[model samples]
Target: MTLMHKILGTAAAFALSAGAALSEPAMIYDLGGKFDKSFNEAAFAGAEKWKAETGETYREIELQSEAQREQALRRFAEAGLNPIVMAGFAFGSILEEVAADYPDTKFAIIDMVVDAPNVRSIVFSEHEGSYLAGMMAAMASKTGTVGFIGGMDIPLIRKFACGYVQGVKAANPDATVIQNMTGTTPTAWNDPVKGGELTRAQISQGADVIYAAAGGTGVGVLQTAADEGILSIGVDSNQNYMHPGQVLTSMVKRVDVAVYDAFMSGADLETGIFTLGLAQDGVGYAVDDNNAALVNDDMIAAVEDAKAKIISGEIVVHDYMTDNTCPVK
Candidate 1:
């Protein structure tokens, strides 16, 4: 659905009168569009699921430009929307600013932390999941070399790459992990052309398995991997269906569940940092029928073993944001 434009004082009355009976959740989708088929799509899936189960409709806006971030948040907040949901970390500063002006409104933001009392920040153990994807990529690689394509050169995406490299090393210490970022700006998230070029470059370096944590850009990475007949891994959502046999597996992060839960919580939605990890079943590797043939029983067993260790604290996946360095990479 189209988003309402941000305007000052127009929604002030609506905000004052907001309550349980008038509560209506609103969502602000991040750039790259909601159908990026990766991160934003996962959040959409969760929002859709909530609507189907509860028969309640919510307002939403898809961001088309960088300026729209704050505009969407303010527009929804001023309109008396009870719980405003934002899809990405880019909204952190904006959400923090808007939330204070509307203290009665509850806001839920995924992938970022907002210190406002009314905001619920949800983050996932993407590194843990990416590590598993790394292990699978390494094991599935015939060339003993794998690659990683990131959407943007941000600390968050680096966290994905570092964990993947760690996983690759754990499985095959001799394996080489090549890495590249689509771009240094937000445009990187949706640049399929750049994604394809990066994939080809990695392949030229002997990388047979590539993991794409590049949002919409990953579509290009996956398509190229399939065209070149190389194994590839997907991120954020279960993308095995995209390439079927050619896709080794997808590092599934449950953005859908986070969104679904927030919407379901309604007016009383809890506000704070909510972290989803392997232990909480918030992040994992996809192993459905789509890629069942590509992942054998041994691979499944090995990954599961590692998963258990990670959850039990026996294995700690280093977070790249922790120190801005990847030991394995």
Candidate 2:
């Protein structure tokens, strides 16, 4: 080939490479709404952090219905989004179905696993964080009883409940835990009215501390707890500030970190199951000014010691999703 022709060929290849690099990352939020102040919000925070740091925008979609999952995934892939990040387990089947159609596209999913060469499944050790939160709830329960409000009656939600119950039992074996599920559908995650009613029922059963793993529904749980003058726990994000002194603490799962890392990794992001546990700083209980006075030195110390043991493999929080049974309840 002539020298000029060779130079032109190389220039064309460079242009194609540059175009691929410029393709923005994308995210599809779960059904509870992007600003649900829980799971979806955490993912949003991560995407915003990436935008702020890199000054690059990303495509985003908030799923309003279950039917939208497959459509959203296909649209993003067809548009050539380098890496599409999803925020919930509900997207698992859809991701798997759509992933096969776009073999070259990289996909990242949080809280669920999609077995595909091009998909990155990010699951967190929520049981570990829930255990810590349970410890605090048990310690702070003046009534010798605590409560757990789950969004859906799924195994993942049960895992959260099981972990919390174990922590509560570890701290106070005699402590009573009252558990309730909002519903068995996606709407369960966003129904604050139902959550408030459930909180009232738990309080009637002598619960003084409540931990909510119900996404947006948790907002109602926190509000009712605050209004009723009881301690409550948050989840997914650091939501202690939601009710300040009324909130005891939050079981923080670093979904934000997972999303941020996926975005930063870009086209070269790793594919496969990425599990985040105490060892990876993927999950923990939050302590901030919102509830600083509520978390005593002893409480903090005990949780820290437990955290260390968990990291060292001395403690294993039971994941209910594994066998669908909780040792504590």
Candidate 3:
């Protein structure tokens, strides 16, 4: 059976009985919950896929507060959950603390690097995918301007914004790309109202197409963009179906694959730093029936050419994390 827990308080603990068998895997979602329709949801999809294919169940927890990070990890480890996977980079420090205590238990963390011997760090080339989304935005814009809204003002989110600016300039050097961040705290991931406000603000600045790299907040960005009769880009998942043709495309990140691979490996999962990028099929843009009408042949051919060049090392999408600087604007 699948064990699901909603941890609302830091004092709350996983209800596993003492000395429970060390068999099933466990997942710990970030503060945005499992159904945020973005990053966490992607991870949930992977876990569900594993359950459907193997007829096996895993344990999971949707954390409700930042204080629950270490608590959830420690409790799950104590319960003998092997190959525990966490869905955010916020777990890096806490995982560092907990992984050493349970050297026998394997752990996997997405979006952050925790150099524990028993931990697997899964990171994505978000900049590369964002570049494609930006290119599409620039190509589709009617006002010669685009926008980007990110969730936390961290290096990771800036990575998305930086690549987007570069792609916009690459497509139209004269194009204007406006950028904003939801906030500096984790709450930035869930505030949709602020996201909508940012969308309108960008639209006022002549941004006819906006790309949202926020988590749940991106939902507001997409909704507001559609309500205002403009195009929006999604992140971390294929969100095209959310608004049909109104959504230009989504920068699809394979968070599901990372979770599925970890769950499939069970206790024997490999532990190392894994970076998924355009070449590894780790990140790319989504094209489906929902938004097929918006993408033209020219756009597809240009994006495909850029993708090939990136994989072949001819086009280097600058990683913002490398130096916290974007060569473009």
Candidate 4:
């Protein structure tokens, strides 16, 4: 074998490897979207992990308008990418139509379910995780009242509120839950100004501790908590860093882990609605480098006890439409 022939073969192999890596699909992030450091960041972490370990390339389309949702998904499909990942509950219906049309391509959506042979729906037992957060807030609250703020009026967001209400009540039956929505539209998650306003309103209503599940809007809630000198709970991702010292603890939803796992296991994007909750490290409390000092050992121990009880089947968190037969409106 001549030296020239050996070099040519090596170059060809390298090109083929590069081509394969570039063929992977992209991800579409919902509005109030990427770098939220709460929700979208979790999905972004998954894409990053894919790039680092699997050598796959993924792009993200930040949704600004409703039309962007359809356009972004279609653009990725037309570009010949496979398994486009979509984040957020807002894309539920969009995933249904796109996945059906692009039978050759695969689609993965988080937080909602759509039935398509080519799609995988990744959901979370958010209620279960929120329930745990509720317990933490109740135990940690000095004011005996905590507030719940949701990003939207959708049933999905309600799940978070319901779990929180139950968890707090279980911990301190006298605990009052003041719930508010950022908005009724998809823009609800993105409006931090409104989120803060609502947070302030809840504070006025006697809520000493507030939990913001309103995506980017939650940032406002965190800011309010910090500015007002009160306690706040974060949602979707570890938000303890949002306000550093003021954020009591975050309801850690392992969205990053979910995104990474899906990327690693591609063939089964269909027939899978991977729900991450307390048991799978999919959701829990966040306390490491950021706000560990803010939470006492007893709080951690109690949360751990609740976790074990949950895992051991002693506690079953309620889904508003399901287990919560007589849900409080």
Candidate 5:
């Protein structure tokens, strides 16, 4: 979609906004939205950045129901915003159609690849971050088994699970990795009830640490951990405060970076792909309030080393949807 450009000398540019700025930094979120604290919340953080950077007011349209996804995209595009951004891979189809329909409005979708001239699709190599988390899970587990709870059984979530399992195997050959999904649909991302139940099930099956990439559902998983006296890892955002000392670590996606950079890149260049990975400082593990004491500095150092390898093209993290695992690399 072609983004609407303001008058060359008009309005507050991102680089120069002596006025009150755009006054409307808008974001369109996929199903889980704000409270999810995983996908949508990260985008909200970006909105916060936009507010901080331009002094422009930002608006967010959250999709509470799956059916509303397309509608939300259309409404945001019709709102005549500069760049209408969408979060989550599940919104790929909706974003494509919406961008096509609103050619004058530039569109950016996170976690998905859309090959449109006017759309800047930003994707993160989540596997690399997940691998480090997987390694940590293995090292911290006393049961020799770690659990993975995903929001949905989609290919994107699967990519996270696959990378995690492989990392655990590479770190501790003897450890077993358990995987479970919150549900089959998008609402699964917000259903904490299912998330808590799944975490308990994994624990019952001898899981020592649970890694959750289940959006809002992850909150429930952490709640289970705190109540059950087990360990849990968070995704997307730094959720260490959710469970304090019990919530081990979090794989930070830096969605805030992606959103702000995309806006700047879109303003600077017309079209291209922006792949934010470890090298770009787009993804990493968080060392915050809860995890400072539990995580070893050496482990963080090891992740940095792995990050360097990936950045230099030495360690290749494969995505299940794009790469085949048949030959077992």
Candidate 6:
């Protein structure tokens, strides 16, 4: 049984009746919908995996607006949902406000930290994975220029860009990187048109490989890169299959693992700040049958060596969140 609900208006949109079973886990997806083929979709995959393995049903809701954040959290908690998982960093403040109200209802939020005892904050070292993707992009680029387009213009996305530029410089110091952000608002996460425009603009500037850290917007980046006969890198999910040979690689963030672990823990979920990085397989680049021919043996060797060095602390990828500044432009 899968109780998937799409909340378009107020909290009243959630149809979970009071008679529903208590202690069941729930998931709340951020904007861009669950099928945006990016971040939220990866989280949905985790919930589906849990359902497939345990034959248990979990409640899920796709948020339609920023105003629905607190409403949805309260609705689920009031209905006795335990260990509710939210898929984006935007939920941090709301979770902080609501976690205290529901002492027995454990809550888990990804990509942000809430200092509450019953709230589990899971963050990832996205910079590390983006670095590896950068290496692949630099090595695969024929024009000596790559581009990065991000969504929401936040420190988190900057972290991705910064790491990528570092890796590109490490691979080819002469390589040029062009970076852009979709927007400052939440709508940026779902704007594929803007993503496409940015990709084309970068292409005009001599970029042959591009990386998209935007959410649904990345779909446009990948599609435009494919249509233009250039290489693109994906974020937060294995998006190589989306464009096959046209996608150089993807910075695969283990958002599914975070959701799966939260659901598997049930009501007894531990509450604390958990960080996932290259050392813990929390982030990586994807190489599958779809794009295996694109990444050759030398590219693999160089990326793997960097991965090991990053994990061993020998290579410190600057974290933009630390000082809100990237070492390289």
Candidate 3 stretches with Cα past 4 Å from truth are 1-22
Q: What are the per-residue Cα lDDT tens digits for candidate 2 across 168-202?
A: 99999999999999998788999999999999999
- Which of the predicted structures, 3 or 5, would earn the higher lDDT when compared with the native? 3
Model 4: clashing residue pairs? none
lDDT of 4 by residue, 251-278 (tens): 8787788777667765445466667778
C-alpha root-mean-square deviation, candidate 1:
3.2
- Point out the worst 10-residue segment of candidate 1 by lDDT: 1-10
Candidate 6's C-alpha runs over 4 A off are 1-22
TM-score of each: 0.92, 0.92, 0.91, 0.84, 0.85, 0.90
Question: Candidate 6's residue-wise lDDT over 192-286, tens digit each?
Answer: 99999999999999999999999999999999999999999999988889987889889999999999999999887999999999989999999
What's the lDDT for candidate 2? 0.91
Question: Which model, 1 or 2, shows the larger lDDT?
Answer: 2
* Candidates by TM-score, descending order: 2, 1, 3, 6, 5, 4
**Least well predicted 10-residue stretch by lDDT in candidate 4:** 5-14
lDDT of 3 by residue, 126-158 (tens): 999988888888899889999999998988889
Residue 47 C-alpha lDDT in model 4 = 84
lDDT of each: 0.89, 0.91, 0.90, 0.79, 0.77, 0.90
TM-score of 4: 0.84
Instruction: Estimate the Cα RMSD of every predicted model relative to the unseen true structure.
Output: 3.2, 5.5, 4.7, 5.7, 5.0, 4.8
- How close to the true structure is residue 2 of candidate 6, measured as C-alpha lDDT? 21
Native-vs-model 4 lDDT?
0.79
Clash count in backbone of candidate 6: 0
Give the per-residue lDDT of model 5 (tens digit) for 124-173: 88888888888888888899999999988888788888888877876788
